[model samples]
Target: MSGGIGRRALITGAVAGAGTLLSGCDRLGRDERFQRLLRTGEGGNYAVLRLLQDRTALAQEFRPDQRSPVFRMNGVRMPNGDDYARHLATGFADWRIPVEGLVAHPQAYSMAQLRAMPSRTQITRHDCVEGWSAIGKWTDVPLRLLLDRAGVSPQARFVVFHCADPQSNGTMYYESIDRIDAAHPQTILAWALNDELLPPGNGAPLRLRVERQLGYKQAKYVQRIELVSSLAGINGGKGGYWEDVAGYEWYAGL
Candidate 1:
């Protein structure tokens, strides 16, 4: 499975798996107007969820024995490109997660550098909106630690993950979280899963894991982290690839 599965195939599998629950929502995938309406509804839910939830609420964590026997790979399985191929071949020895945009000191961290920093490990469940769930252990550096080291600017309002994988529409895959989520204790840039160096199917090298949100919010194959005041100008301005294409909610809070 090193080559990984195609993005369309993964979506189809998810759609099929959740068909029973999505009986009336099928067309939302292709209807732009409906998607916008759907987003509006999701926005309201988000507002209410945020209002009622604690600022630093933590997602439930599990014990090692509770981890799922098999964790399905989500989102883009393999990023397409010679450069990515080279990194994969070299075991990401030369790969870097560049931190830039609205930061006082922009910095890029190689795998070694990122691994050298203090890391946190947690066994947690990943609930996908597609009506499935899996529990796995994730280990990585807290995003705030990196942001502090980078000296994130006071004006920055959101952290955007620029990934190596692109959607079928050729739009580069990305996801964003507000400053509040960025500084959450469970929010990390994970480089390992299940106590092992993350496999390609599970976002090797690095990935964003904002534990409080649903699986879609966890952007994988991350290449860069961009700090910005707003997501209004990125892609379709929906804050994420699925949000722009599949009408998936941007704020997929549990």
Candidate 2:
């Protein structure tokens, strides 16, 4: 599991108070398109910046009222697949995220069971690689809890997310994160956004909110989770779809 800190650092610390995050989401986030058009730091030079990273450093969180008025979707609104369609139609009554590979007690967890577990609600900023951002309130079960229950094996070095959305080439999109971020308090498999059941356009059923990284790492329409020892041979094996296909870095921290 590789990770780094994004040196395109606009924030040095948490925002001061209520409505501050909302102001950025509505006012600054949108306007940044122009700012980003002018300058970009050294391209993908993440390794050097990572030396100063605090793996435990929390991404800046916000007040509920500070959530973006319009939380933009990162990738396709809905994934393509008959199984996903069936699950969606039934409100995911039977859909389950199978925790497989390198776990002592592997099992698929249903949405009902996940919701009944200990949950955390957070309002955090999602920084996109494209230079825009949004503050959203998300409720999710901590990934650490699920991993603990499943008893992840010591050999499992990376947590891979197998998603249902496919790209133009017809391959499904997938992403991976290491155990350090996996156990981070804010790393959650969120089922709700903005105090409501996720809308189809917003990764209904489930999505990952790995707040420390870029939006691309926050995979949507996730179908299964595989804990693997290495990323080689998985898809393009660079750690994520964009990382493999688009040359994005595997560990995109901010």
User: Against the true structure, whose TM-score is highest?
Assistant: 1
Which regions of candidate 2 are displaced past 4 Å? 1-50
What is the per-residue lDDT of model 1 for residues 1-254, given as tens digits with 9 covering 90 to 100? 85598899889988887886586567665588886676687779889988987989888999999999988997778888788889999999998888999999999999999999999998888989888999999999999999998999999999999988867898878999998899999999898998899988888889889988899889988999999988998988879989888767778894
* Residue 200 lDDT in candidate 2: 78
TM-score of 2: 0.80
Clashing pairs in 2: none
List TM-score per model, in order. 0.84, 0.80
lDDT of 2 by residue, 132-251 (tens): 999999999999999999999999999999988888889888999989889889999999999898887878889998988899999988889999999997988888999888767787
Candidate 1 residues lying further than 4 Å off, grouped into runs, are 1-39
**Each candidate: what lDDT?**
0.88, 0.85
